[model samples]
Target: MSIVKEFKHVNYLWEDSVAAKLAGDEVALLIYRSNLLGADLRLTNYGGGNTSCKTIEKDPITGGKTEVMWIKGSGGDIGTLKRSGLAGLYVDRLRSLENVYKGIEQEDEMVELFNHCIFDLKSKAPSIDTPLHGFLPFKHIDHLHPDAAISIAAAKDGRKITQELFKGTIGWVDWQKPGFDLGLQLKQCLAENPGIRGIMLGSHGLFTWGDTAYDCYINSLEIIEASAEYLDQNYGKKGPVFGGQHIESLDANGRKRQAAAIAPVLRGFCSSERHMIGHFTDDARVLEFINSKDLDRLAPMGTSCPDHFLRTKISPLVLELEANANLADIDDLKEKLTPAFEAYRHMYKAYYDNCKHENSPAIRDSNPVVVLYPGVGMFTFSKDKQTARVAAEFYTNAINVMKGAEAVSEYTSLPRQEAFDIEYWLLEEAKLSRQPKPKPLSGRIALITGSAGGIGKATAKRFIDEGGVVVINDNDSNRLESARTEFNTQFGKDAFAAVLLDVTDSEKIVNAYNEAALAFGGVDIIVNCAGLSISKPIEDHTEKDWDILYDVLVKGQFLVTQKGLEVMRKQALGGDVINIVSKNALVSGPNNAGYGSAKAAQLHLSRLNAAELGGDGIRVNVVNPDAVISDSKIWESGWAEGRAKAYGVTVAELPAYYAKRTLLNKIILPDDIANACFVLVGGLLNKSTGNVLNVDGGVAMAFVR
Candidate 1:
């Protein structure tokens, strides 16, 4: 039967008018189709699937039309693919590899041969699935890892179900590692099952094809949607999901408290091999799976889809806790966490010993990429925030697969040997080796106060450039949002998050750190730059002036840094705290009593924190920036006039006066201060703490003795 286009859940998105506009452009239609398919995680996930199209194009040298294939390239996600992200290969040349094709053992060699088939000099490197796409006879193809299809593919009677779902229209192929051999098997399956619309690769994914891009898209949707409908109709027929909930979940607020408490602790343990950035999700589905009885039995079986485990790892570490355990009791959790992580690492080492081939990349980080907690949620960690987030998403997909597969039939994961082969595949290792060396702060998370402008914003940018994820906390909502947008654009949306917060508000400070916990796992660096000045003589300073100055500069810095320390202590990961004190803290001048005294308090606070936090591996240092007149909101707020008056110069001459008085004849700017913050936390001062770095143009009076 032809496609039964009943999209009760996954909708039909192909617009006839849009497809008509791109009728003659095969590659454009393919990309459009790929984007549509990828837009919904229910259909396919980030970087999970590959789409391909073949077209007749003019040969650059021959001046004749030639058949060329355009396929989503390695490291490219179908949803965000661009022209440059597609690899263009001469179809005839790609097919010529078959003449010299060897067996499955030589499959890794075929990927190198694909480079020789490139028809466009600028084409991106082809993905490992290139041969699978090239070998197919169809002009357009989609290989998607939709949960619905994979549910049936992972079902115990998967082959039998595939035959039942499409009858003879969709053929079935047995499992084999992805490569030249599997590509040939796909071609053979289609040839044998003549006129089949698609084929189901056992324990793999769905494959659909058509003569045109539009037809190919519709074909993929029909198969996936039908599989979804089948699962929906059949779910609950067998029994309750995951053998029903084994434990009831804590209330919403309680769950967050527990998750926040557990996040850094888990992150610390997981970072044993290397520092890991973290992402957490209490997504209802995730909670359901973790709270279920089958979690213990099933999670160890691992994910059925290769794409899922490639990010989530072969399996997840399921946190075992007593039913109705005290969610707020972190000490109890810590006791359990230590032995649990030790057991997990031991399990992983043994897994490697059992399955590793001689050429396998010497055992990778044995730490789990994914962790499942009952009554709380899921936490995923990786080398960067994006990877960590994507891993969480993919594992949630795995959860859905497990749900559907169990509802229909017993869920099955790839055999351990097979999973090991793919996970430690030579190709995957090559990809890892080719990855760029990590930036200094690759997985570091920073929480910067007053980050909406001036030194804070510049420091946030510097940390982001060095691969740190930042939380921009400032009381100015407008400027905070503007800075957030600017950094999001310059660096990527995942680079930073913004919180409009009053630092002195202890409650808000707590919430901001919790937000940081959820946004990037834990804090690795803290920058206390929030300050305001009440620059008046002691006699002119009213009680209110002293209170406001101390509230902002002294108390606010204390609260923000204290909260940051809480997270850093939980992470148990050595962190850096850079306090943006000022030169006035050391060098007293007229009309600077209140502001200067507050800066002095801020400076001393750093020392106090440094002394106490040393054993915890958190280094506290001070950066004193003087004459940072440009772009400073504090400077704009009457402090410039007060400082200029005290220095015996006009506001405009303040810069020149400060520059001339300096031993180095330089005026400090926000970026210069940012550089000092970066230097202290950027691994250079790992061995130093309680020290103050002066960013002011060398002033003898301000020099720390």
Candidate 2:
């Protein structure tokens, strides 16, 4: 095995060639510098920082060049930043806001003023840090929340340490929330410290500046590198970290097993206010800190950086279990979650009650975004998969910050009142209000069998459009890879996970579900969409044909659903299972004994499972459709010709013939079946289960009596 290595310093990625190409363009050079800084987490976390450049642009009304400050906009990552993602504002107009800035009490009123100062009519929305950048004297500034910079900024004696480490090269300012007031304070600090290159905001982050882009980028990296080296020199000098690691970490496979076993329950608990997607990690650092003695003491202090707390909430909820717990201890861990969660809510509400300002927005969700397990790993939950994943990344940043501060000096979190004020600030509430409402299935995860193409693909796409995550699968490797790429492109990388495996193989089924558990928290809806067909008269039906049909249709659904139960049952949150049965399950005909009987078995299996699993809050239902010819694998696999032969019609006429026979004369399609599946599980008829919905255009014989 190869030894793993850790990077101790942020790399200098500036290339003179790349900069030379954009020689005359200041805004383009600014974007290039921002991307280089953002490419490394050591510089700053994803979406955690902002960068800026001040250049002269022609005033729309004046017909003259005026100073304009271009800064990173509200919600995009700096690493992937583009010119359009910047909010270009008139610096003169921005600085003019001091005329009406009625002191700290009226600071929030300043946000509205920034909109009136937009230089380009199409500029992106400005962030709260706009004033911080516009008021600065430097031509280029980097306001980054680098984990290393934050470590020194968050220490108990941070200001004193700043004086000692950089010898006044970087000055310090006491903590104040970002706004008009903080901007003025920064201006004052620069005035007091002659020849200083940057100002380190106490318990927040560092602000570094330079006359040119390269100077600014290099200055930022140099400070971060020094901070990291200082911490590395002193870490554990006092004693072994976390009192010498009281509990041992589970082995690699056991860590995954334990993480998967309890992810669903943790996800459900975190979804008390709204459904949530979950992310799990057992990185060595996470395991190291979680298994330590100080886990209980340090977790409650909350994060010092506002960027960290904004995504992770004030603090994480710790789910404790016996020392050295392994996969067999999952039941005990599950039992601990309920009490731990309930207590966490109580704790958070009390914090709000104690610290909320009169004008603060109403209390938001009390559920912890991050959860910690002593012998296992970390789990983070949020309204979407990406957010949850990012929350975990942020908490990991917090852990690193904590470790660094503790090593060099006492680690101090933001004061309680300050944390609350920043968390529930009114401006933040307004920003949240402007966001679009979540789709009905925003936080759900569905696993659809045979989703490489056809009905399965359509159904998965529908679920995804409604904001559901999916675990898609097919036995065909080529089709599965194509579907994976297509979905990843159309929806997003986080929208779906594709697995290639046979449904009838139990080992493969178990392995596939494990992948689903890790990709998402677990499954909340399971669709048995994999199927095949065989058409033969009773006399001509050979045993091989019968076995193949049953194996692919009946046995396949049973095996897939059986494995899904393990995940759903543990979640304890009510779930939905939609079976894509056929109308032939109810309406019998000649030359279709093998396929039709298997469909009937599938229908009965749904009913039986509904009866058996209902006590566990699982609803099993069937969607029976006929003649769904468009994009159907079953139709393409010789079933169309066989059905046409039996009906004494050409293959091309099957759709018209089937539609004509129906009362509504509607042609059934894969999309129609997809809609039916969505109807059953999309929270429309939550109370109705053990039922069959016919998407066959009013087939009277297929109707349930």
Candidate 3:
């Protein structure tokens, strides 16, 4: 069934309206409403909605004050807008003026009036809808034409049908010119229906209002949703099937070979197809669309949401791929694509020039928003794959809706200039602007196993603080959950991902790496922090304990390192891997024979991997830290008492006794261990590989390196 339904009572309001009403002595109500409006629009995409509100008061000096309206300034989404987002205007003065102010009907008069009165007390011009909001009677008003709204409206004689369905229950406004004229029409309609809860502007959008902000938001969502349910009962289509035939054309090596082999054939075919290729299609609609003689009615195949413009650009590629045609030659394909690409560039330049005003910045030249090759699938551009995926997702939704709209009747879009205004507006440009880079690792991906506590979490935080994207893996699901939530709060959902899996399991390790790759692209760095410690005299050490330590400390690190090497090798990129061994590898520790021997073996493995993988530009290193005082279970057991007795110290003071031996006189912290790991992997040590770095506060002086 179609995925269109009015938002339930649960998620109707995008923000807490109670916060808007609670604007105290410091914060103004207008500013709160502006912020709330911005947030809502930002959360929804693809021409989903707009918002506005009114405020009144008397001037303290004249014992007389005038009322004013402030609406979410146009062309800006709530996600990035500030209080300045609200365009201010004289409410009573605007209300007194007849809706038809201009003698000649100007298409954008409402938008123009908004601009005319709300002068930028600061230097910028106000939006064009300020006055329209000023003329409305309600304190708060919101309008949205979301995907859900369209889904319900995409049926036989949609507007007339919905009108008949709701009869007297819902007020209806015919699709008039939007902006000032539409506002005026709405004002008159509201006047006639004084107690109307909500109104559906036929073929336009839904309008909801309330004495309080929350009620208005809720009422708007409820009525629209109710209408959608009514429509669903009468007409529904099966949900779109997403799974497609898995085309396993090539593996990594196979793709490279295919690309080389097919490039020449494709190139030759392009020479002929460029001339006669426009006339073939697998689908009838595709053929009709390509052959349409009316250039003026061309559908804009981009996103419905404005933010999508940043990712997918303003259009899509129209490819002409036929089942029997020759797509085998790369050069021929290039020959055809070259002209279409040039045409796209010329069109883009014209679009940019037409949209240009005195205040806009130049558009980016190389990043074409959409590429339409006749036969191939559409491809959206993003700085990274994650963003492009979001664009692709929105494209799917938008294409379906546009198709449904066409099926009912003609499918039109927002006016070109209006879309351009929003598309290239300086304020909107600022909305998509990124923050300054955090560190060398800002966009790089890293995987750290056993990261929920101790060295793992410490290392994860250090990476994050430097602007790195991190994926934490641990066997403890509960700990991973807690760590994931806490870290996400600090770094955004994109910056951190937590996986629960045992690194010793080869299949699990491979799957975890795959997940991280999907989440943040290929992994760039790996920190194997999942080792173990079992302290016991050689005579007391059990085979089971010995096996466990070796399995986790040595085997886990080895398997993870192997995966890291494979990924880095394929990418043809340089990367780092730091193994958390121990100083015990250099100097033997009594009653911890199992822990010491396992660490020693892991250290040797690191050196071997480093030597072998260095040819592929992968650096492997080890951090040897001594006697950490943190949550190490071995340090807390009675074995600690045995070690303390041997050293002539009480169990309580054993940690202090160990700390005093360090030359730095300060206890070695996990942060210090993490810092050491960073130094070895970071660029400063770019030339160094297969090195064992010590981080024991000078407690261990070894030549084993």
Q: Pick the candidate with the highest TM-score.
A: 1
Clashing pairs in model 1, backbone N/Cα/C closer than 3 A: none
- Give the per-residue lDDT of model 1 (tens digit) for 211-255: 988788888887888899999999778888899988888888877
Give per-residue CA lDDT, model 2, range 1-705, as digits (tens). Answer: 112223459877777878889988989999999999889987888898889999988887979989999999887678989999999999989999999999998998899889999987778889999898888899999999888888899988888888999998998999899999999888888889878989999888999999988888888888888889988888889787765797888788877877777787787788788778998899888888899888888999989999898999989988766534554444665676678888999999999999987777888899999989887889899989999888988899999888888877888999899998889988888889988989878999999998888789999999999889999899999989999889988998889888997987898888788887777888899999998887877898899999988888898899999988988767777789999998999998879999999999999999999999988889999999898888777876778888899999999899999999999999998889899899888878999999998899999988879
Q: Rank order by lDDT, top first?
A: 2, 1, 3
TM-score of candidate 3 versus the correct structure, residues matched by position:
0.65
lDDT of 1: 0.87
Clashes of each: 0, 0, 36
**Candidate 1 structure, TM-score to reference:** 0.96
Question: Total clashes, candidate 2?
Answer: 0
Candidate 2, residue 304: the lDDT equals 92
Model 1 weakest 10-residue run by lDDT: 322-331
lDDT computed for candidate 3: 0.58
TM-scores, one per candidate = 0.96, 0.94, 0.65
Clashing pairs in model 2, backbone N/Cα/C closer than 3 A: none
Worst 10 residues of 3 by lDDT: 273-282
| Between candidates 2 and 3, the TM-score winner | 2
